[model samples]
Target: MSYTVNCSILLTDLPLLERPAAAKAAGFDAVEFWWPFAGSVPGDRDVDAFVGALRDAGVQLTGLNFNAGNMPGGDRGLVSWPARSQEFLDNLDVVAAIGERTGCRAFNALYGNRQDGCTPEEQDELGVQNLVRAGRAVQRIGGTVLLEPVSGADAYPLKTARDALGVIAQVRQNGADNIRLLADFYHLAVNGDDVAAVIENHTAEFGHIQIADAPGRNEPGTGELPLQQWISRSRQLGYSGHVGLEYRASQEDPFAWIAAWAHV
Candidate 1:
């Protein structure tokens, strides 16, 4: 069982180049980012430079999270609004192209908020339709889009693994093969579900996994959830992919938590 650190944890004050190097120095071979390509990180840091830093540090680019599009007065996502479908597709194409260039094969497609205007059934259908289009685009770029079911407290629609699985099934039923699922431990624990069971049952549809303990959303050891047990169970379920450490550190230094994982 390999592990990858989510660069967002160490990206606070350091430059983009230093983040991956810090992760590698902390003993991670791969790293993930929430939205590093958004070009909002001050200075002229671009995707190519970020990728070059990863290569120089001998770290693999694991995953790139797509924009959720839930701004103040903007279109949340393609699920509830049909007019933004083209915009969603175009954004996906741009993101996928960047992922291909960075050697990242997994991308997280955030299903945006569920407004009062759309019915539950309507939202489900539209979400599937948009995913089908996005999935096709991802397939063209040799990558997979994992649907992350944000917790209800965190987002509007798709609050559980069950909800995400339904969306993935709908996409498969529509003959789309590029869409998959992401099982995040923090979200699962917050939603009160068995993370290991969900991963075991949905292994085929699951492409990536992120973890943090529940309640505080901090590193695994800081919360009440049993991280080692989940990792052991994941191995039993035949998950060969890297489990991403997407948690915040309670203390200032991130390497402290990394050193604590040495026993596991």
Candidate 2:
């Protein structure tokens, strides 16, 4: 698997419009990002500007997230909240249009942390309904909808690859087979899963793969996880998707980490 820069975590020192060019300068022709701009749905001008930036930078958008709700404000995601289902659904069209513009074929929809006064059953029901719709939308665009296991610290329900896979299965049962897993190694490692084994055993089931070192969600080689071993093992297992660089850039030039992966 090759690498794709996650601009949301990287190039923070630069403006959003400049990050894709920065990634391109760093030798990455592909990039992915969480929701850009201040809200779930930005204006058409903002969306056009974003797509234009990617095009002007000559970078491919391999993946994108549906509105997860004010990420910096602790809104882990809103896709599963019953009351926010409409907002989530509305955000789908926005992301789908962006995907069409960028030729991106993967969309990740985060299942938010549990909310006050809402039952798990209600959240799950709403989540299924929304994901089914999302799955169908992306399917029309020749894309795959993704579900990822976020950290427990965020109080999010899905905390492991298996957790996301279970939901993927449920989403499939609800009549959307386009749903797949977004396997983030750092979260799985933090949650105490055998990350390497997961890759070796379930690589075929993953739609996207992201990585950061364990103990600290920093760049590869900055923490305890044998990122190279697992990454290399992933390629050996025939997992052909890009291994997204979703880790935080260190104090030093973050682009340097890209070279260190060369020996892997």
Candidate 3:
């Protein structure tokens, strides 16, 4: 029953270097981030410092995202971008290095948005190719590559558990069985999918589970989604993984919703 805080969205008020400690103070022993650096392949020294901050905070690095191109501005990923495929491949070594150092075993690789000139099929083909290679690299350190569904992502193709699972199957077929779906309840609900049904049917297929109350992506008690119940049900269905608290806090005591973890 490990719970991890997503520093990427959790501690927007604090400096990047201080977020891990803040999360630790809030009682989260595990932390996850969406490529803290602005670029896909940041220098080694910068990575070392970031990793050091997590260590000093005494929190486990439970999950991480590969360099999703310009996430805040809307670029979802680089793997599928024809012009950036090589750069995406090159970044794998960096991810593998970070994985080795932090002992974080799960990596989320967003499937990039649809390009103007590239057809969806072409984008899918390139993404799978790069993802397969990424899966292999992460496998060296005993890690899994996770695919996620994004809401309101017109260019991003994956919008449901089934959609991500489809891509996972393709990657596995290409010989990387370490690929798995990242079942994020918030995105699933926002996309109008039956989140409960997804949990019951795809639990075993999930490598990780992330939660944020739907509609507003805020603390659990502030939203309508029964996240705690879904988390409990997910575990009952055989999903043994970290439940990442990838939500923004609306309350001053960001961890007030932690009570829901035990209640569920």
Candidate 4:
């Protein structure tokens, strides 16, 4: 099992230039980041510089998130919002170009908002369409798109493995094979689902795994879940992809946590 550090957590404080160097020094094989570009939106960081840093550090760019909510407007998610469709597609192209430059093979293509009036079926259709468009862009660049289900609080959209898998199935049924699922343990735990069982049943559709404890949303050991056992079970299920540590650390120094899980 390969391990990756979520750069959003481990290197949040460091300038983008130093993040990859710090992650490499801390012994991580790969690093992932949330939307490195959001059209100059507030809180959006410089992506080109970040990519340069990763290249210099010799760290693999394993994953990246492309959706970061609509900028200047408060609306989140891109599904079912016809107005944002072109913008979302354009952004996917830019992110895919970045992935090509950084040698990244996977990206998080998030589904946007679930408004109050739309039916579940309608939302599902819209989400599938958007993902297929994004997946095609990724495939053109030799990358895969991982569909991540956001929590209700985060996006009012797909909030469970089942929801994400539903969209992926639809994409495949429509003859699009480039989309896959990103099973996030934190969201599963918060939604009161069985992470181990989900992984077991959906192994075929899953391409990546992310973990942070529920409640506190911190490192694995800090939460009540038996992360070690969960990881062990994942291995048993033949999950060969990298398990990304997407968590906030209680300690100011992220190296301590990395060292603690060095053997994992």
Candidate 5:
């Protein structure tokens, strides 16, 4: 099994454009990231530099998040935020452009937190609409839109495979069959989901898989998640995609644990 480095989390010490080259130097040929810009549409220069970096580093861009507003400020996503519905919609073209350039077809859309004024029904309805739009936009590039269950934010509602899968069903019902689940084991484990059972039963539903250990969102083996076993089980169930290394490195070398799981 090969791994795709999550440049957004694993290489924080480097500048954004430099991380891809660094990932290549660290022996990875593929990478993923959060939306690399603050706004929905970045200037042409910034977009060029980003795509240039990936091409220059010879790394495949595997997955990217849609513009999840103010992630550092606790805004989980904009898909369910009514006020930012247009913002999310505007981002689809940009995302499709990048994916077209980099051959990145998997895009993660973080479902926004529950808002104060919007009823759950309204927010969910809006989320479905936006996701359906996203699904169609990406479909131009033969892409799959991803919905992930996040952890540690009480306001963020999607916390299990079932939660994300439910929304995926709704998106499909609304005429977007390209939506799929992003099975990030760390988040599901932290939220008390049976990660093993999820892998066992839902491997067919996964479009992408990301991982980190529990207790601390650090590299595997720094915590007690039995990550290797779970990874093995995922493969046994026929998941052939690259597993994303999305953990925060606890040591100078983020890939020290890679040696321990060489068989994977």
Candidate 6:
């Protein structure tokens, strides 16, 4: 029953800063977000407004993504982009600062898309290095860095749990044991991963779990996914972290689809 509203995608009718309160009104005490700022290191005023929103809404921050560049423009992340490695590093300072204030410990680090000039091997190696750095930085706050496998982006690598775990293995081998898999069930299902088997085999490795009924990325019962069963299975298998409601709303009120989490 530990669930968190992903305010970034859920309450779209409200302003970015206003969504946290909307989520709280919808009955979720914990919330998460994608990078809320338009820039990697937001101005002090912007950061204060953001942290203030969460405080006013009285919601606990459970999960957050490091600044993934231009998401609306299709940039998945900068963790592996050699040219933006410094930007990614600088972004971590802000992420750590936010975590320090909100008591958030789970951070999602999306892997960048395949670049035009760089070979896959080069990006992969660079990715491991960046992840190791992030892992070490967040570990000071008793945090865990989450690497998620995304769907719908062909150029974006790490399309499945095994693929993400492979990169996590490299990070672990490099001495950053704080890194872990962010098992996003919708992405895994869309990529043809066996959801049940993934939970059964790697429940111990999951740092956080997110869900959307796939085929449309809508709420449960709108799509064909057996989400409640999968959620129950994950909990039964000892996955105690928050389940992030990270999906696009098919209707004006997305939470209506789940009936205030009763159906979910």
TM-score of each: 0.85, 0.96, 0.97, 0.87, 0.98, 0.97
Compared with the true structure, all predictions reach lDDT values of: 0.73, 0.86, 0.87, 0.75, 0.93, 0.90
Residues 100-201, model 3: lDDT tens digits: 998999999988888998788999999889999999999999999999998878888889888888888999899999988899899999998899999888
Clashes of each: 0, 0, 0, 2, 0, 0
After superposition, which runs of candidate 2 have C-alpha atoms over 4 Å from their true positions?
A: 152-154
RMSD of each: 3.4, 1.4, 1.2, 3.2, 0.8, 1.4
lDDT, candidate 2, 1-264, per-residue tens: 278999998899899999999999988889999989676678989998999999999999999999888787788777888777788888888888888888999998999888889898888888888889999888878989989988745578888888788888888999999988888989899988889789988888889889998777987878888888887787788877898999887757775666656643
How would you encode candidate 6's per-residue C-alpha lDDT over 152-250 as one tens digit per residue? 899999999999999999999999999989999999999999999999999999999999997899887788988888988888899888889999888
Error (Å) of candidate 3 at residue 136 is: 0.6
Better of 5 and 6 by lDDT: 5
How should the candidates be ordered by lDDT, best one leading?
A: 5, 6, 3, 2, 4, 1
Model 6 local distance difference test score: 0.90
- Deviation in Å, model 6, residue 168 alpha carbon: 0.4
Sequence-dependent TM-score of model 4: 0.87
How does candidate 5 fare on TM-score?
0.98
**Candidate 4 residue spans exceeding 4 A from truth:** 40-47, 70-76, 116-122, 152-155, 258-262
lDDT of 4 by residue, 1-264 (tens): 278888866677887568888889877769887775545232324665777788889899899877656523555456455556666776777788788888888988767675666675777777788878877888888888888765536545677888778778888887679888888888787887778788678877778888887678887667687776777677777778888988877776644654566455
Candidate 3 to truth, TM: 0.97
Q: By lDDT, is 4 or 5 better?
A: 5
Best prediction by TM-score: 5
Candidate number that wins on TM-score, 1 or 6: 6
Scored against the true structure, residue 144 in model 4 reaches a CA lDDT of 87
